[model samples]
Target: MPHFHFHSVRLVKALLACAMLLASYAGAAEKLANVTILATGGTIAGSGASSTTTVGYTAATVGVERLIAAVPELAKVAQVKGEQVFQIASENMSDAYWLTLAKRVNVLLAQPDVDGIVITHGTDTLEETAYFLNLTVKSKKPVVLVGAMRPGTALSADGPINLYNAVLLAASQDAVGKGVLVAMNDQIHGARDVSKTNTSTPDSFKTPELGMLGYIQGNKPYFYHVSTRKHTADTEFDVSKIDTLPQVDIVYGYANVNPVALNALVAAGAKGIIHAGVGDGSLAAKVTPSLTAARKQGVLIVRASRVGQGIVARNGEANDDELDFVAADTLNPQKARILLMLALTRTSDSKQIQRMFYSY
Candidate 1:
């Protein structure tokens, strides 16, 4: 009887071991790639009085450690960890901040242990940072930038899901070489072309000229195309040596536009000025004097359209050739501002800046 009991015990152990092996195989198939989360304080880390307010929340409510604990399920997707770099509002970010952020990303991306990186930033300036990363970091592995318009404590906080999807994409092999991406409101947008169109809506981000690159479903990401922006390891644009970016101001065009602001910026040591022209990027009559005077002062001039879409061309309108301003092709005013600052870092020649506008 004792021998019979021992044999039965051996059979039970064998059956249990086989079941465990099968379960492990199935679990490994759906498992995600390794990804890292670098948290810079933003709405994603914010909290409200209750689960009712979103935009009205304060950003200092949660730290990186708590954020990780708040979402324990993240461990199931990746070997996730968070580091608190900064806890400031995104609108207050500066060129120096951009430099620091870029350097950090570069270091993490170079690490063999880190397969991917996710930056948690504020929605106010998330696109700009994304574009900056899109320009600077050179990694074949996926780098995703995500933000929340609503705080995590809000009734419909969008941070958790956005972070999840962004991290998912970051770890996915398919997302490699796709450049930097911004995942928000279930949509995946390319970094260079994406913009925040609405302040209150959950589905606020949009690529003016380009559609979404992909979408998230049930925590899984699907990609349709790759980002073709000239960036990291591909381009010569560097952010480290940029101590003081050239001052570039925007002059908006109205029915009766004035150049007083333009001329003042020039007088105040503005290195560059972007004139937000009227229809099809036509300079306002009042702005012509200031723009011409700016030209005489050796200040770099850029012409961008007030309208959100399309390209800008110089010498298109009558009396435009005499102005001699760089035309912002397909680049919006703010983007043109960034390019102008970057271009001025290397050369102050109008021809060279114009060439950059065309090429970049």
Candidate 2:
């Protein structure tokens, strides 16, 4: 009966091992971070006619819940919950939407259970929205923006993998206080520096001059750089009480540009106008008269370069100090418009506005 006792001891040891395995898994599950995905429909939610179709597809066809289901691996990384914030393409993103989104993000980040947030957006205007949130979001919690160049129905769909990496980045403690980030094509970019450079490729978003903040490898984010400019929780811009953003418009500069466009925008009650100047943010002689007139009318004028990568040095091409114009340092025209809108809400003094441009 010694043999029976020996077999029973082995059985008991096996049961104890099983229990330990189960306990370890339970501990890991409990440690998972709680991440909420705020989905604003874009190509990531678009669906084509067939798996091979990429272009000419219907965008915003899928909802947040469906997008979440498409990426089952997201569950392994975090306790992810999806919210259908808006079902329109990012190109249709409006200032009203920005206010609503910023408010909602502020509210959610205030909760104790929320560890981070991931926003699904369209590549077209993703940089603009990311920058806006970078300025407005009050909390230090990680906020990530992600998008796909191809529709989800394509044979080599990239949405699912991109979503997985974004969730991973958001859940990481290292991502906190780094400002809002854009994760696409396995690259992590700070909102202020990144812009969509390509039309249809997955590697569209890039910070060509400053380079990416980091990159995602093996489902983890590794940092090499962080934006030194003020962002998130540090900026003076607040959207909590703001109902509507001020009217800010952009004008392109070219050889012998007509001044009528500048005059028309001022007549339309634009609070701020960004001249997308040519070469070092130069003000053409033809449009200078109109700009001077607009400035006298209490309109804020900012000169931003049309070049993809370069700084619009203050008082370089034009006498910013004398002309009372603000230069957009290292900001593209589209992003310049965003900062000008927020700056107008606080003050219109050219000096103060220029300070905001440099600080943000």
Candidate 3:
């Protein structure tokens, strides 16, 4: 009887092993999240004259297919497809391109097969584009923007790892409802707050005020905070019908600053002027008259600090109320310009525009 019991136990163990093997096979066959890589060209696609050379290299030379092919590991993470929306150095990124990209993102997110999106962009204007999408994209699916500080052909080039992390983040279920994300150097930052702090480095992007949303470790994303700011489906800005954004210009403030740039912008029919002030969004006493004149001409004036960090307090440093101008809150000048363009589409009232600045 004991011998019979032992044989029965061995049979049960064999059956259990077969069941586990079948389960493992089924798990491996599960469909991965479909991530669409919208390559807009950047240093990530740039090719240097030599592997040793980093600077003075040709940019936007590589295409989307090549970028995808460079990262074969992506196939294990998610099903990724590449689409070249346009290829240019990010410095040339324009409002029309912004509109086109935002519209495409919306259309793809609406598709049942598409789970998320990854945008390859140049580091120069990456933050601006990210912020624009953060305000305009009206979906809960993940939208990740990535760029490399080094050219794709350089030694230890950062593009592959950054691109891989971007795909990983885009495919993550935790990335949903996080607004638009900027992934660089294994750090995940929200679009509204992240900016390029370093001129040339892999760890350039950072959220100075609120900090990063999370980081990627061991090929897995871990989140510490969700952005409290309104974004994605919760945002008021809509790009579905927006073919063109209003003209907005940025003027840099300095000691003995002349108003020529500001005046030129007004003459050029600028709908809004973003004053990149010295500190706390302060304008030089000499430049205030030009700004006031611009405001009188029905040009919306927004005070944004050139300083990399800290918020530009409303009514404290800049007389926003008296000049009928809006304070940029925490937005830098470039990002402030993006917001002003979208805000102009809704209302030109300084009070109403200020409310938009505070809220968005």
Candidate 4:
């Protein structure tokens, strides 16, 4: 009888310990960060006919709910909710779309229940969208943009792990106030510096010059740096009241380039033009007159480099001061166009815009 009683007591004690452990786990789960994934439809949501198909797949076919379902492990990192913001390939991303996405991000971030946001986007314009949100999102909470080169149906699709890591970043306290970030192929890059470098590789998005913000290892994000440029809550850009963004265009420069494209863009009601000039943002002599003419007509001209990865200095290749132009200062033509669009919304003063170019 005594032996039986002692054994029963041990069993009861073990049961109590297991119940306490379960309760502790429940408490920890309740404390998990609430991350909302605003899916913008990309290769991450793409699907192909066969598991072997990687390149030629229909993108944005998979919905957000299925994407969240595919990655059940997301529950382990954070309490995730998915919202389909847009279902178009990021290459089709427009200014109106930018306004909508930015406003939605602001709205969600304002909610007390929301913790952070992860945007699943197409690789084509992922960097652009990320940069747009980086400038306009009005919160310090982490906003992570993630994409995959291989479609979800591919043999070894990268979307699941990328999505998982993005959620990890979104839920992390370390990611707060880091502006906007892009997580791809296990690397973290600042939105301002990251660009899609390759057309179809998983490791395509890269910050060629300034380097990436950090990297992910063993499903954990490790930070090494953050962007020095003003972003997110620190930016003066606000699209809540604005309906349409000003028309800004990009003009590429090459050897013996003509000014017809420049004149055409200006005539087409371009409020601003980004000259993707060659080598240090140099202007082809033939194009200078047209740019100067457009400048005189109250059109903003920003000289950016076509060389892909270099700073466009104020007086390096062109006399921006004399022409009353704004140098892009490391911003590529595409990104320069985005900044120019937002800058035009505030002030068209070249000096003020010039300061913006430097500041942002």
Per-prediction RMSD in angstroms? Answer: 4.0, 2.6, 2.1, 2.6
Looking at model 4, residue 119 earns an lDDT score of 95
lDDT of 2 by residue, 1-360 (tens): 899999999999999999999999999999899999999999999999999888888888999999999888898999999999988888999999999999999999999999999999988899999999999999999999999999999998889999999999999999999999999999999999999999887888899999899999987899999999999999999999999988999999998799888888889999999999999999989999999888988899999989978889998999989989999999999999999999999998989999999999
Candidates in order have lDDT scores of: 0.80, 0.94, 0.93, 0.93
Off by over 4 Å in 1: 1-32, 318-322
Q: Quote the lDDT for 202 in model 1.
A: 80
Tens-digit lDDT track for model 1 on 1-360? Answer: 999999999999999999999989777854656677888888888888888886577875578788777778777778887877778778787777877888888888889888899988888888888877776786777889988888888886888888878888888787788888899988889887788899877888998676789887887888886655576566567766556667777778788776677767788898998877777788666677778888888888888888888767667753445666788877777778877887888889888788787766
Lowest summed lDDT across 10 adjacent residues in model 4 is found at 310-319
Clashing pairs in 1: none
Candidate 3 weakest ten by summed lDDT: 23-32
Over 1-360, each residue of candidate 4 has an lDDT whose tens digit, in order, gives 999999999999999999999999999999899999999898999999899888888999999999999999999999999999889988899999999999999999999899999999999998899989999999999999999999999988999999999999999999999999999999899999899988887878889899998999986889998888999999999999999999999999999899988999899999999999999999988999999999999999999988888788897888888999999998888999999999999999999999999988
Q: How high is each candidate's TM-score?
A: 0.88, 0.94, 0.94, 0.94
Measured on C-alpha atoms, candidate 1 has an lDDT of 0.80
Q: Between 1 and 4, whose lDDT is larger?
A: 4
Q: Which stretches of candidate 2 lie over 4 Å from their true place?
A: 1-24
Report how far residue 281 has shifted in candidate 1, in Å: 1.7
